[model samples]
Target: MIKGKGYLKFSKSKNKIYVYLFGRLTGEEKKKNLFAFGRLENALENMYQIRESDRLPAELSELGFNFDDLDEWILALETRTTRNNKKINLPVIEERCFEDVTNYDLLGMSEKEVKSLNKDETFKMYSDLLEMIFGALAHIEELEEIEEG
Candidate 1:
């Protein structure tokens, strides 16, 4: 099942999460983000090399996501396709947010944007973005259950 189905928002000030769904997304848009999300999930899996613990900081841990949950949620989002008669794995992601599926292209930052941030700044930004992604994953799981039930 497609989880989140769009863009997810996390409000730092209010400590709340929101999801904006793009129920009208085109096929190309969904395919693009699906690949993007798959890439992101693969990166995270490779970096951690383990998804059995809480990877968030003490403060952000309050957001209620653990690496394990995020891992499982992303696994649930996986879909299969065939390219050149070869079975390939992809994600089932939809474009439903303030912006289009381009939001899923986490690595789309320009060289200038990348260089402007020092290591610490970049890590902070990465952590914050991760928090949002985890929140989105949890929401997707819930939405999937809702749809199933």
Candidate 2:
């Protein structure tokens, strides 16, 4: 399995189903992939419009996310505050929270594995990965390391 800092895992156990967020891509990286990030941002913004909680899983499904699989663990939704400072909690299935991941590996796929996927599959894979990475990036503010002046 390709383990890295910038990945999300949505797993289902006999008793529970959940999503965990790992590391996030840097600002430069996000800029280079603006289209993907744009979709994610738009999605988040759109999510606020539908205030119903029960519809989230179905909504995620419509957006190419299948929560039934174990290995596909891929979302860590946070309650986002709007410009007016109103909190919007868009829950997926169960509890959603971010786990600290210190590594910087972007994709866990190998060359052969990536090559084997069809064009549509490849695009979906990238979209999903970017969605997760972008989601994490949008929620948290990255801190800069300050050296002694």
Candidate 3:
């Protein structure tokens, strides 16, 4: 599942915690699963806090979640909160045309030879570059948040 941003708001009037999950809800099953996982997290945390004074409950396995499932849930929570809520102002990513790279011989290859490569190769390279750029931006945002906090 792709990570999406979400917010948990405590509604005093309704006496309920309202969760706002920002993502595509394609089916009823998916929506139910998401809500269940969120509630499970809250319950687990509350139970652990009540049971243990300072230390964490012995490795979540004791708390009833299989280690693998716990890891997956933690990963999903992090992805949703960190990637979705964290905002970054990035420069417009420029899409390079075939002509743009023609001037430079990539890997010392001639312009003609480079141009002969399939469009897939060119697109793959661009995608990898953009991924790296976004990763760096995310890291920077995390660092700023840490410092501010």
Root-mean-square deviation per candidate = 16.7, 19.7, 15.9
- Compose the digit string of candidate 1's lDDT tens values, residues 40-105: 434434323434353544422343435554444334333211222333322222212112324434
The residue pairs found clashing in candidate 1 are 6-96, 7-96, 20-96, 21-96, 22-96
Measured against the true structure, the TM-scores of the candidates, in listed sequence, are 0.30, 0.25, 0.29
Candidate number achieving the greatest TM-score relative to the actual structure: 1
**21-138: candidate 2 lDDT, tens digit per residue:** 3332343333111112113334433333333242444523433433332122212333233333554332232211111222324446555555566646654664465558666654
* Consecutive 10-residue window with the lowest summed lDDT within model 2: 93-102
Pick the winner on lDDT between candidates 1 and 3: 3
On lDDT, the candidate that comes out on top is 3
lDDT of 3 by residue, 1-149 (tens): 32332222222122223222233233323422233223322533443333335443353333343444444334333333333455322222223344566555443556665566565665555445445654565577579779999
How far residue 112's Cα lies from its native spot in candidate 1, in Å, is 0.4
Off by over 4 Å in 1: 1-110
- Of candidate 1, the 10-residue stretch with the lowest lDDT total is 7-16
In model 2, state the lDDT of residue 19: 37
